[model samples]
Target: MQVMEPVQMALPVTLPDDETFASYFGGENSLEVSHLKSAFDSLATTFQYTYLCGLGDSGKSHLLYATCIHAQERGLSTMLLSMREVIDFGPMVLDGLDALDVLCIDDVHLVAGNDAWEKALFNFFNRFNEPGKCLVVTADLLPDMLNISLPDLESRLKWGTTFQIRSMSDDDKAEALVKRANMRGLELSDECARFLLTRLSRDMRALLDVLDKLDHASMAAQRKLTIPFIKSTLQL
Candidate 1:
């Protein structure tokens, strides 16, 4: 008789290198950050299942990516799935995910009104709840607030420790921008950071994107992150 080989599950997304806990500036969401950092530890028994919710660009997804990175660094099997991207592929995409040591689902609220996905997720949640397994989910709203059609799935989501990741203040955003720039080998003055915040969107993700563009443009022009250079390059 021929032996049947176990199927391998292909990850649908790649974890960004810069989204680790070290690169993240927790700001007002320090408690959420701390919980995620230790969620995968052998001694972190209470964090077996965790949920994070916050508005857009509030660093919820970043923390999820950071969690996956932390788990993989410890030689554990991990997977981070974005519900927004995988919802179109049907619920079969969730198959075999329970085998992972750490599983993170981002933007789970995207699956709120879908019956098939909801049922599949509920089943997946039960199977993934065994010993030594960690499941972390992120959504834009609390489980009770989400428009989840399945009552059981909604209740299961709330069963875990839920945290509301608060948005950072303007001062913290400026400091975080400066720190991120420093990480990229760029010298960004506090004044310049604040200038970008004022002239552009205050969202951290948007600010970081602008910073990335500035980084490349600055390197190419051998210029500093001056306001004039920013205006010329980004047409701000």
Candidate 2:
């Protein structure tokens, strides 16, 4: 008799090291942040599936990763998947994910209109109903707004608490930049942070990308972050 061997699997997405609750600047979305944090809190007597909706770069991905990180720190098996990255592999990539203690899928909206993907997600959603496990999903639109071909999948997405992370104001964006700079051990003063807000794209992702460049430039130049340094390094 021939026996089948075990199947080896790996999550196709990498959760960035910097994407943590401490490093995330909630800005005006503190209530949303609190809801996510509470969902992952171990002391809580119950676990709830969490769905986060927000425009691109509003930290939906950040919060998803943060939940995975929190679960891992508690010695739970975690998987982070991005539809944008793994959809090319087909819906089979989602197989066996229901066994994980925490399963986080980002850009779930990308699966919209794909019957195979939507059906797979709907089944996966049903399998995660076991106690002590969590499934966190994020999309750029509300569950009702997603173009999912499967009505059950759309309904499943809204089965749990949903939070919409609102866009940050200009002042909040400036403060967020400074907070992120501080997380990187850079001394970004209010004036410099405000200046960056004015000069860079308003999108948080773009601002963070510019910050990465500025962090490198500051290190290479052996200078503190200032308007002059930023102007010279970014040529803005």
Candidate 3:
């Protein structure tokens, strides 16, 4: 018997160590989070073609990366491609991707209205329909709302279960910031979190980026994440 190996690609992107499910603050997106976490289970047939749609900073990319990490941990062959970064490389970037046990395409809507990419994705979807293969896609819009010029490609997008990641409320965002801080061994009070929210962009990605900067700054200065320290370190 010939042995088969997992398909390995030299992807330009790297997943963040902190973007796992444990660090993700689900808030109102608990169901979507749960579904993505189990996407690779043997009995998760309905999740073979999962689609996540939401506005920017609504955690779509985070969930996609988290799913890939989960699948990889289970010893499954997994690949995560961010279309936003690879669109310029042309549709050939998707070549042989179906060979992986799990494939996650981030910002898939970036290929919308591009004929070649759309057609290539349509074909990839068809080729990835095997029983054990799972395809997870994230986009800023729903399948029907995408500006895809290819009718068949749009139809293929709807073949899977779709979930809209809801935006986090202010209180939820504050709580999430504190939880993320705790995960990093930093103490971020609810008041401090609310203060940071007021001072920085409310977008989760931006907030997280700022939090990362604070994490570094606090470690260097050996200072807690107090409002005064945050303002001085981040120039807020």
**Candidate that scores best on TM-score:** 3
Identify the runs in model 1 with alpha carbons over 4 angstroms from their true place: 1-16, 27-29, 43-47
Q: Is candidate 1 or candidate 2 better by TM-score?
A: 1
lDDT of 1 at 65: 76
- Write down the TM-score for model 3: 0.89
lDDT on C-alpha atoms for all candidate structures: 0.80, 0.78, 0.80
lDDT pick, better of 2 and 3: 3
TM-score for each candidate, following the candidate numbering: 0.86, 0.85, 0.89
Q: Model 2, range 1-236, lDDT digits (tens) per residue?
A: 12222221134543336768887778324776677667767433555788888885578877877777777777667777888889988999987777677778888999999888999988888877767677788898999898778889999999888888876777877887788888889898989888887877888777878888899999998999888889999887
What is every candidate's alpha-carbon RMSD to the true fold? 4.0, 4.5, 2.8
- Cα lDDT tens digits, model 3, 20-81, are 78877783258887776666665345438899888756777777777777776777777778
* lDDT score for candidate 1 against the true structure: 0.80
The list of candidate 2 runs beyond 4 A from truth reads 1-16, 27-29, 42-47
Question: Which model is ahead, 2 or 3, in terms of TM-score?
Answer: 3
Clashing pairs in model 3? none
